[model samples]
Target: MKKILILANNDVGLYKFRKELIRELVKDYKVYISLPNGNLIPELEKLGCEFIETPINRRGTNPITDVKLLWRYKKIIKSTNPDVVLTYTIKPNVYGGIVSRISKVPYISNITGLGSAVENGGILQKVTLTLYKLSLKKAHCVFFQNKENEEFLSSNISIGNKRLIPGSGVNLEQYSLLDYPKSKEIHFLFIARVMKEKGINQYLEAAEYIKKKHPNTVFNILGSCEEEYEEKLKEMNNKGIIRYHGMQKDVQKYFRTAHCTIHPTYYPEGMSNVLLESAASGRPVITTNRSGCREIVDDQENGFIVMQQDSKDLIQKIEKFISLSYESQKGMGIYGRKKVEKEFDRNIVVEAYINEIEKINKSIS
Candidate 1:
């Protein structure tokens, strides 16, 4: 069997979002995965991937660490001698792309997001754009998660071949339509890292405002705290404003009772997986008017769209959800499920990769 090597920053995202693609690839290829060690290694290994314990400082901007990562990718590519390389996230995509090009290997780069550094422009953005242009100029194929990302890269850099995909696409099977919850206490869920860029403060402020009036309503928060919001989150939890369930492995359980999902993120996302999964699970979403968040919502149809960074607007939308009758809320969730079924199936993403890999194989032959 031919070999396909994968490079990424973390195992959680790879296993959570792209496990289906990996499963499909393992059936026909010897899949090698290089990423930072995490909880999902055994699960990925079970899917027939040879795991390479790669150390990557995901948030650092140190050039020395980046050089080490580049060196590591070069060594992995040399030793594994894979037919093709697949890279995800920023560090892997940029550094891994360079090594793949120099080693004469066909590689596909997945532009997962522009990230905060790129989105919050500066000298760093210019440096990042320069690196992306240098690295992705010769990629076999570059897949974008959103149209904005595609347009941004196109204007800023020269890419040979690029395509847009549905932000990694939700597994329709895994996130099957759930029964809309039937309860007097309206439950709203927030599923993302606890960070300002993700609009956690907006969610918290809305929670505080909404809880003051609707005492029976519950606001739930899941995922790890990436920043310094733990104390505030805990205080809110104690005050019965929101329930902070830190880093849940099984969010579907939480989804079972959630009436709606709120994602008020301002981050430059390739796509918002949380929104996609929520919609797939037959729960309506209320998110920002940003690219990744807006694409999934059909404003007052599947979910409401709030203005970015405006807690007052978010509170108003939450209040709007509260005003809806139970039947109307359920109808909104049903609409959301149908929307995901039509547009964001993971099989579409899998098929795209398979087709691209087959084309590369044919060219090699």
Candidate 2:
């Protein structure tokens, strides 16, 4: 059996998002996954993936420690001698790509997101782009989650092979459709990591503005809170302007109960999985008209897309949804469900990955 080694920053992310894809690949290949050891090691092992714990600093940029990571990747790859390698996230794609190239291993990479380095835009962005150009030029195939990122990277670098895939693809079976909740109150839910970049401020601004007018409507936030924004969010929750659900493992449960989902994020994303999961749960979405988030919706048909970073535009769109008849709102959600079924099914992503691996094997033989 061909050995396939995969690299990622953390175990939880690898297990949570790519579990299905890993399951699909393990049937034909001896799959090995490298991530920082965490509680999810057993879960990945259950999927038949050989769990290899590798140290990775998920946050921070200490040059000396980072250089050690590069050397460790080289050591790991040399020992494994895999036929093919695959990687995702920023650090893995950059460091792993370079190591795979140096070891002469056929490898593929997935650009899962353009995080703060690119979003913040300054010296960091310039340095990040330079690193991407150097590391990604030699990969066998490079997959981008959204077209905007694909266009941006292609314009900036000399990439040899490229493929654009729907953001990590949603599992329809798991996030199956649910009947719209029957209630006199319209419930709008926001599910994301609570931070400035995720547009938490715009969401709160809209919620604050809309609450005075529509007393019966409910605005709720369900996410892990960041330290800087935690007190402010808690204050809002105390004021009864919006309810804070905090972070929950079963977000699909929230989706099933919610009438609509709002993701007013301006963050440079790979693709907003929260939007996809909400859409798959048969709920209408309200998101920004930006790259990763916009690609998921049909604007007005499935959900509304508002201007990024503008709270006024977000308020207007939320109000527009409030005016819609119940049937129309439900129709919007149904359209979203159909959209995912047609375009962003998890099976499609797995098939594409398998095809690339097959091509690599054929070329070698």
Candidate 3:
């Protein structure tokens, strides 16, 4: 049986975005998973794959430690000796890409997001881009979640085999269209990492302003958080500006309840999973005009696109939605669900991976 090595930064990410793909691949290949240990390990192992606990500092930037990570990846891949290696996220795409190349193994990479280090564009971006250029040079294929991301990386580095998919593509079946909450009050949802880059402050500011004008409405926040930001989000939740549910496993409940999804992100993203999931759950999205964020929205068709980092615009957009009748708002959500079904179905992503793997296999043969 053909063997495949899957390397990533976190098990949660692999579970969230790549689980469908992993399930489809495992039937035909010997799947070996390498990632930092987390809650998803048991589920992953249950799917008949070997899981290796590889400690990774996902947000760290020490040069010495990063170099050591590459060494560790080399060791792991050397011992595993998989026919083809597939990796996702920043560290694995870069570090694992390099290791696979050194081992003379074909590898595929999914650029999930451009972290703050590269998105901020300073010395960090320079060093990171250099690493990307070196690592992806020999990759079998480089998959990007958005065109904007693909164009940005291509401009910085020469990636030969590149394919674009819509933000990992949501599973339409898994996230079925759900009935709206029975509450008479309107609800808006903000789901993303609780970080400044994701416009957490803007979300809070808009929530405060909108809630003041429209006392009957409510705003909800969800997703994981850093300690520094978690306290602030919790404080806001306590104050009743926005109800923050930190690190939710199932987000469809929030989506089913929301009249609209708000994602005013300023960070460079491969694509926003929150936007995709929101749309898949049959809810409209209001996000920034930023690259990855805008792909899910059609600006007044499915949802509105607010100005990035502009709290006032975010407030205005939320107010405009409030002005619309419930029926009209529901139509917007219906349109969003249709759009995701046509363009962001998980089957498309699954087939793409299968095709890519087959292409590589034939080439090797």
TM per candidate comes to 0.98, 0.98, 0.96
* lDDT by candidate, in order shown: 0.94, 0.90, 0.87
Per-residue accuracy of model 2 over 214-310 as CA lDDT, tens digit each: 9878998998999998889889989999999998888877887799999998888899999999998899999998888898899899999999889
Q: Total clashes, candidate 1? A: 0
Would you give me the overall lDDT of model 1? 0.94
> Is candidate 2 or 3 superior in lDDT?
2
lDDT of 1 at 131: 89
Count of backbone clashes, every candidate in sequence = 0, 0, 0
In TM-score terms, which candidate is top?
1
**lDDT: which candidate is best?**
1
Off by over 4 Å in 1: none
Query: Considering TM-score, where higher is better, how would the candidates rank from best to worst?
Result: 1, 2, 3
Residue 308 CA error for candidate 3 (Å)?
0.8
Better of 1 and 2 by lDDT: 1
C-alpha RMSD of each candidate structure in angstroms: 0.9, 1.1, 1.5
Please report, as a residue range, the 10-residue window in candidate 2 with the lowest summed lDDT: 51-60
